[model samples]
Target chain A: MFNLFLKTMYDKRIFIIAWSIGLAFFAYLMLLFFPAFKDSGLDQLLATLPPELKALKGMIGDISALSTPSGYLAGQFFDIRMPMFISVFSVILAVGLSVKDEEEGYIRTLLALPLSRIKLLFGKLIAIVVICVATTIATVSGLYLGALSVNVNLDWTVVSNLSLVMLLLSICMTTLVYCIGLSTGKRGITMGLGILVGAGSFLLTTFAKSVDWLQPYEKVSLFHYFPAVDIVKNGISIWDVVVLVGITILSILLTIILFRRRDVR
Target chain B: MTIQPVLEVDAVTKYYGSFLAIQDIHFMISKGEVVGLVGLNGAGKTTIINLIMGFLRTSAGKIRLFGEPVLPENAHKMHPKVGFATGDMSLFTNLTGRQYFAFLKRAYKLKDDKKLGELCKQFNPDMDKKIKTLSRGNKQKIALISAFMSGPELVILDEPSSGLDPFMQQKFLELINHEGAKGTTIFMSSHYLKEVADVCSRVLFIRDGKLVKDVSRAELESSHGKAVHITTSRAIRPPAQSSLLGHQKTANGYEMSFIFKDSPIKLQQWLCSISYMLDFTIEDHDLESAFSDLYSKDKSEAKNV
Candidate 1:
């Protein structure tokens, strides 16, 4: 089963590597080249966007003290880039491992095996988590390496801190999408819904702030606890850690329950 | 000969909404026997297999596998004990034949890679190309390998010879016979009676969701081939048919080949009186005739009924 997960994860390595490279380039161009834009809130760029788009990319984390290489790298990677990477990773892993198997007729072969449904789902979830962690660590390290060429002070504390925070948020989103993927028997539906859930949460959170009446809806949005911007500015909060763990438990439990109850197509 | 029944289906009836697919289907297969479920398309052969596999719910009746009821939760686990290859089952397109074979081998918990390789080499299915690239016959060979890879006690194949060339079909027959010789019970369903006759020890005839015949190989061999044709050496004496049976004249003479349900000897004596000397003999019955006879009966009886 571990081998099965590894085999599937190996197939998606290209996607992860490509994404990490793209994230590194974005981080380098925005942080190193255009330094002033870090604080410059282009109101047109931020405000003209629809409410959903704004809500999706919650308040940007303050990277003010991010003068050093590691701080700037961590601020960019973990603040905005890591969440996107994690969400994409989570959604793809969840959908690929769950729905794609059925859509491609591999599930027939997989189910023909002498394993239980829960076991297959459990192994896939573990594989998704492992991929998420490996990709996150690589993307963060790559961002830092990109900063290395620019000659800035290194700070492992900030990088590790940011990684940990992003890891928590990423796992939560992955588990949630993983469950949704299991519920959706087809690949297209799973992929579509997974993207919506991940990106939609972010937009919902941003919209919640602007519309006072919709603020309560923000509490349920995963971006509410993601704290990408907040974590960089204020460090990790105790409540965020607690809420993240709670999210993991809730999502995993839902995944297991859905797997057990849902019919395997 | 005393032998254990390898598979038993008892009073099983399944319904898809108001559409009744199968009704009270009951049958059993002895150990090492090659059993064929003979049915036309839409006669509910697949439905029966689905119920046996616990893929669909049975509204009534029960199916016992090796004397144990197949519980819903444990049905998937039964794969190791039973190898099933369906004609319409979708093959994984991305995996190469080798990869797919290896996957099934591991899934079935066959530790000996050498054995798996040897078994595959016997059929010589292509390993380099993905399933999507393979021809229909080659793809079927791959499917057969996966189905037989587990070396289970029972193998249920639906339309097993479908899409195979004559050579492959013969190979398929040999493969199934090999499994049977090794004490594997094969319960295959096919619309082609000749194919089933090649390997099946018993033929179970199904029509309109009912089992009409459970004839053994010996019985089928003896009866399925007997065809009766009566010809006369002399002209008929009276009204087309006195009352014995419908009569028709041929180039030879007046002839009547009413359904011959009696021994050739008895019918010979009876026909001798009708003509000075009659040229009459029983022609072997082929599947086409048996099928036509049965179907014609069904149609006629249905109209009368």
Candidate 2:
């Protein structure tokens, strides 16, 4: 299982490293030259937004802390950097685990090896976890380095706790993708469903916030489970962490059940 | 003839939803024997391979290797001891042949790199290049090298000769024969009857997903891996003719066809001494021709039924 996990990481080693460095370098440059933009893309975007659009992104205008450099990194890291970077990360992990193998016909090859379907699923699961964990660490590390450069009184505890939160969220989201992959099995359909489920879940949560009746739908939104804003403003949300971690376990159970029953070919 | 089978597929059936992919196939492959599973396209050669590898579900039958039941979980345990290569199983494109072999080594837990190279070179593959960069035949050789690299006890190959050139096809045969010499059982499928005839000790013809022919070496040799058909241009007219009708003299005489048993030497000499230019064409028996004879009746009968 570890061997398969290492190989999968090797497949995306160039991407994880390259993407991490690229995001870090770009974030560092912003801290050095364009501090205002670096610190306030998400905050400024939120402030200028109409009520409906703000609800769509699950945002409320609260940016007094954006004046501080370290506080600014937290906002941009979660909203701007993570949305695009995490989407790309999930895409690569899903493709690596399911789509690429299905395309190459190596799924059948691996199946022919002395590994059970569950074992195979576990291997991909391990790889996906590593990718998600690495990505979250990279984002936190980038902003931490930027904070050091700017010489702000950085909140190490806040950073570490929030980083763990995002890592759990990433895991939950990616495991959801794995379950989708298992059910669909085909590359295009699995990926299309994964993105739709991830982004669509976010969209649903945003919409739920706009309505009083749809408030229950907010609980189902993966975004609803992790409170990035709460983390920056008032420390970690214990309920949010529980909900996110619960979703991760549920998604993994789903992966195991569906993958075990599905036709491998 | 007296030895036990290394692989046994007994009453094995596979269905994809409602469609029966393969039905109750019963066959046993002895050690060191190269068996050719001959079939046309969509004849379920690949399905049988999947069943044997436990990549598929058995509808009503059982696949046993070394006298143990083959289930999904157990398949992997059996797979390490069996090497399989097919046209569909692509080697990693970005990885070189050596790298892919190394992965297989790690996967199968092979320790000796020297033996891996020897197994690869035995199949005439260049290990330094990536698989995508290799030619079609060389890619196949690489696949074969990986499958055989573990020195598995049994090998299952599907349509190995399709992409290979004539020279490479010969090399493929030599490679299979070499593997067989080492007591590895070979279950391979090919369209080329001559190729199967060269090395296969037994020829199994699959028609409409059923094992129609469990032909022995003697039967294949006698039939030349085909059903010999003799067609004559002229008809065989009997000495005593019916006098009930006065018939007009047709330009051509009567003709007859028979299964030609012997070589053309006997038939050709017999034709040359005749006064008339009677045609005595000998048609070679092949999997295609034999299969046509075997199942061509299904079309008309199915319509009536």
Candidate 3:
């Protein structure tokens, strides 16, 4: 099991490095623009904006709060850019863990090894968790360093809480994609469904803020549990953590059962 | 003393969503036996291999390896004692042959690389190059090396020689023979009947998801009988005393051909009775023709039904 885990991680070393640098750089770059927003009368500009632009505010959460560092970071980076980037990255990595191998006929070689299906899947799941945690750390480190360079007095505990929730969100999305990939064993189908779920969750959660009818279904979306702005202001919610963790554990269990029974292509 | 069979598949049947891939298939391979499974395309050859390896579950019945039931949960436990290879199997193309073997070594947890070193020497694949960079035959060599390097007691191969050239195929056959001589139980499926005939002690014939024939190598050779072709000056009725199969006439009824199953002396006596006979030739039947006969017979039988 350890060997399989190490091999899986080694195989994705390049991907890990690229995503870490890319996310960290993006986070740092986004923070560098925070100084400009801090002094600019953006709050007044936002208040005078057309009423129709309220939907954009709904998506970004509390546009008037953009004068503060946490609000600016959440609105510009965490709420949209970071989640979307991490979602895409997680889906790709999750699919490669199983469905891509099955599609390319390499799963047979892996299955022929002296490792049980449960161990094999758990090994891959561990690799995904480690990668997600590493990338989350990189993003937080970038934000921390960027905050220091710009002389912003950011609260470390709030940032850590937000990063933790973000990591959980990434894990939840990745495990869901991994489950779908193992169930279908087709790259295209798995990828299409993964994107649908990720994008749909974001859209549902975003629109639920303003649409009265969608408000009731907001909790159904995985993104609703992320609550980047809320986490930045109020710290992590235990219920949100429990929901994401529950989904991840359920997804892993479902993957193991399906993978053990399905025929290898 | 009683010897246990290395592999036993009892009444195994598999279906893919109401489409029966294989049905009621049963066979056992004892130790030191080199068995060949011969079938045409989509004849459930790979399906059986998958079942035996526990890659696919049996819809009904059971398969046993080394006396324990074969299931996905326990398949890995037996993998250390089994070596498997197939032509269509894809390798991690990103890794060089050396790297791939190193990974396998870690997976299998073998104490040393002595067996792997020997197999590399024998197959002589380009170990330094990436698998994707190698030719089809070279990749096949890597697969073969992977299978045998573990020194498994039971080696299961599916179209194991599909990508090799003639010389390389001969080398593979020699390797199979060498392993068979060393008490390795080998079950291989192939479209190449001559290769099967050369190394296998027993042959299993499958057609349309059914095992049509199972015979020993000597039985297959003798039961195929002699193929005779004759051209005579005058047309004559084939003798009833000679048990001929697939008798056919051509060349304006002057040429006749068929498989003769009777004694050669009896055939000679019958041939001597044909006064107008001009020429005749008799040759031992080959495995290819025998395979054709089995499948053709199945087709005719299906048509009758």
Top DockQ hit: 3
Task: Give model 1's DockQ, 2 decimals.
Answer: 0.30
Instruction: Quickly count the clashes in candidate 3.
Output: 0
| Residue ranges of candidate 2 with Cα displaced over 4 Å | A25-64, A69-76, A79-84, B1-4, B225-256, B263-280, B283-305
CA-RMSD of model 2? 5.8
In candidate 1, stretches whose alpha carbon ends up further than 4 angstroms from where it belongs are A10-13, A20-30, A33-88, A184-192, A254-265, B1-5, B13-23, B41-43, B54-61, B88-93, B205-213, B222-285, B289-305
Badly placed stretches (over 4 Å) of model 3 are A45-55, B223-225, B229-243, B247-257, B261-269, B275-284, B297-305
Reference-based lDDT, residue B55, model 1: 50
Candidate rank order under TM-score: 3, 2, 1
User: What are the clashing pairs of model 3?
Assistant: none
What's the TM-score of each model vs. the native?
0.78, 0.84, 0.92
lDDT of each: 0.69, 0.69, 0.84
lDDT of 2 by residue, B205-229 (tens): 8878888778876776655321222
Which candidate, 1 or 3, has the higher TM-score?
3
Ranking by lDDT: 3, 2, 1
- Residues A1-265, candidate 1, lDDT per residue (tens digit)? 7656765666567766776677556655544543454345543465667766565443553344344444445445455555665677777667766777766656555555566666677777777677667766765666566556555444566666677877778777877777777755656777777788778776676566557788777777776676655655577788988998887888777766656544443
lDDT of 1 by residue, B68-132 (tens): 77644456666678887877566766678887776676667788777567667777888889878
Model 3 lDDT at residue B223: 57
